[model samples]
Structures are given as structure tokens and as C-alpha cells.
Target: MGSITERLSKKDIEFIENQKMFFVSTAPKDGKINLSPKGLDDTFKIIDENKILWLNYFGSGNETAAHLLEDNRMTIMFCAFDGEPNILRLYCKAKAIQERDDVWEEYISHFSTKRAARQVFEVTIENVNNSCGMGVPLYDFIGQRDDLTNLYNKMSKEEHITYMKKKNLVSFDGKDTKLFED
Candidate 1:
């Protein structure tokens, strides 16, 4: 069975902190929905019972940021693949703070990434829910991958900026991500 709550309790926060990865979902008013798997150390932070922040590294698509521009609706999900059988969902309204934004530095400081972050998603949680995830398959825990960090380390700042301008500026559905545009 599933249960809904108004806020994230301490136990909930602890569960989030222990999870290795989570999925972020977002969508425009009318278009393809975006669900991304995010995994990296210190990539996510629980700002409070009602707020959460996650660092958005450069990727092939910028759908989440673009979708946020069109609509604030977002959902984050975490499933326990070890020790416990629980799945948690956070229903939220989110805003993408791009690298060019004034407050970007503040949020970026929460993460330690060698790769240039395209944006930081700030989510205001509206509802919290948890359900038994007994059906979810368990997997062994492994160390994080360094491919992204290695690639970013090789690129100069200008090259990184150019790459973001080219690839992260637009969503798959033709929506602007506002990554470079003020």
C-alpha cells in the first residue's frame, strides 16, 4: 500500500541520502514527457522538508529545463533497491536556474562536479508519497562512473560553454531551455 504525506520526515530524508540514483520527470503542457536518471555523488540535496535541489550536468537533451520553462510540474522518484522495499515520490513545482542566472552559483555550490553544470533544478515539494516496492529488483552497489567527469576535465571552459549553447539550448520538442538566453 501507498501513503501520502504533507512533508518529508527525517526518515524520508535519510532514505533519499542513502539512495545512489533517482529519476526526475517533467513535461510541457503538450509534448513528449521527459524522465531522466540522475546519478553522481553529491548531485542531489534536500534543502528542507519542502525544497530540494539537484545539479543538472550537461547531457544530450535539456528537456527538463525546457519543460520547466513551459510548466512547473515535476516529479522525483527514488526506489530502494537494497535493504528495504520502498519507493518514494515527490510531487513538486520546479524552476531551472541556468548557469547564466544570478543565483546559479548559490545552488551550484551544493554540488561538487568536475563537469560544467547546465542548470540547477530547484523543486518545491507539494506532496510526498511512499509505497511498497517489493517488486523492484535489487542490485549490487558499485562505485560511481568517472566518464563524464573525465570528458569535462579535458574540455576548456570555452569549449564547454559552446557545447552547452549548441546542445543544451533546445529541448527535443522545440522548446527553448533558456540555458544561454537571459
Candidate 2:
């Protein structure tokens, strides 16, 4: 059976904290829909029962940020990949808070990461759904990957900004992510 609620319960928060990875989904008005798997530690924070913050790093595409600029609709999903058969989905309205933004420092303090974060997404959860994930296959737990961290550590701040300008400022569909805009 499936259940729907307006706010995250203690059990739901525990499940989210235990997960090693989660998926973020978003879509442009007339272009590609983006679904990304996030696994970096200290990049996710629960603000309250209805709001959460997600730290987004410089990636190949800025689809989520671009989509959020056009439309705030976003969904985050978590699954029990090793233990119980369960899936949780949070439907939300999200906004991208870039490093250049005034409120960046306010939310950035909630996370503890040395990586060059492209933006922080402030997501307000509108609905929560939990379902029995019986059809989902189980996978064993493994340690987190340090390749990205190692690579990031070796780059200078200027290099990081240059990479973001080339890759993180635009979406695959040619939409402006407003990553560096004022």
C-alpha cells in the first residue's frame, strides 16, 4: 500500500538520513526532463518538516537549475536499496541559490563541504509519498567515491569558476541556468 502526507514524519526523516544516494527530477517547459543521482555527503540538509536544502556541484549539465528558473516544480526520491522495500518521494517547489546570491551564506552554512558548489537549491516540500518498493532490486552498500573530491581539491578556484562558466551555466536544451547572473 501507498501513503501520502503533507509533512515529513520522524520515520521519513530517518529514512532520508540513512540513504546513501537520492535522485532529483526536474523538467523544462518544452525540453528535456532531468533526473540526477546525488551521493555526496553533507550536501543534503533538512531545514524543517517541509523544507530542505540541496547543495548542487558543478556537473555536465545545469538542467535542474535551469528548469527551476523556468518552473519551480521539483521532486526528490529516496529508496531503500539495501534493506526494506520502500520508496519515498517529496514533491516540492525549488529555487536555485547561487554563490553570488545574497542569501547564499545563510543556507551554505547548513552544509559542511569543501567542494566548489555551483548552487544550493531551497526546496519546499508540498507533498510526501511513501510506497512499497517490492519490485526494486536490492544492492549492497559500498563506500563513497573520492574521485570527484580528489579532482576538485586539485583545481584552483579560478579553474572551478571557468569550468562552471563553460558547463554549469547552460542546460542541454540551451536554457540559461542564471548561474552567474545578477
* TM-scores for the candidates: 0.96, 0.98
lDDT of 1 by residue, 68-93 (tens): 88899999999998998999999999
Candidate 2: tens digits of C-alpha lDDT, residues 92-137: 9999998888899998989888468888899999999999989889
Off by over 4 Å in 2: none
User: lDDT, candidate 1, residue 118?
Assistant: 75
Candidate 2, residue 64: the lDDT equals 96
Q: Which residue ranges in model 1 land beyond 4 Å of their true spot?
A: none
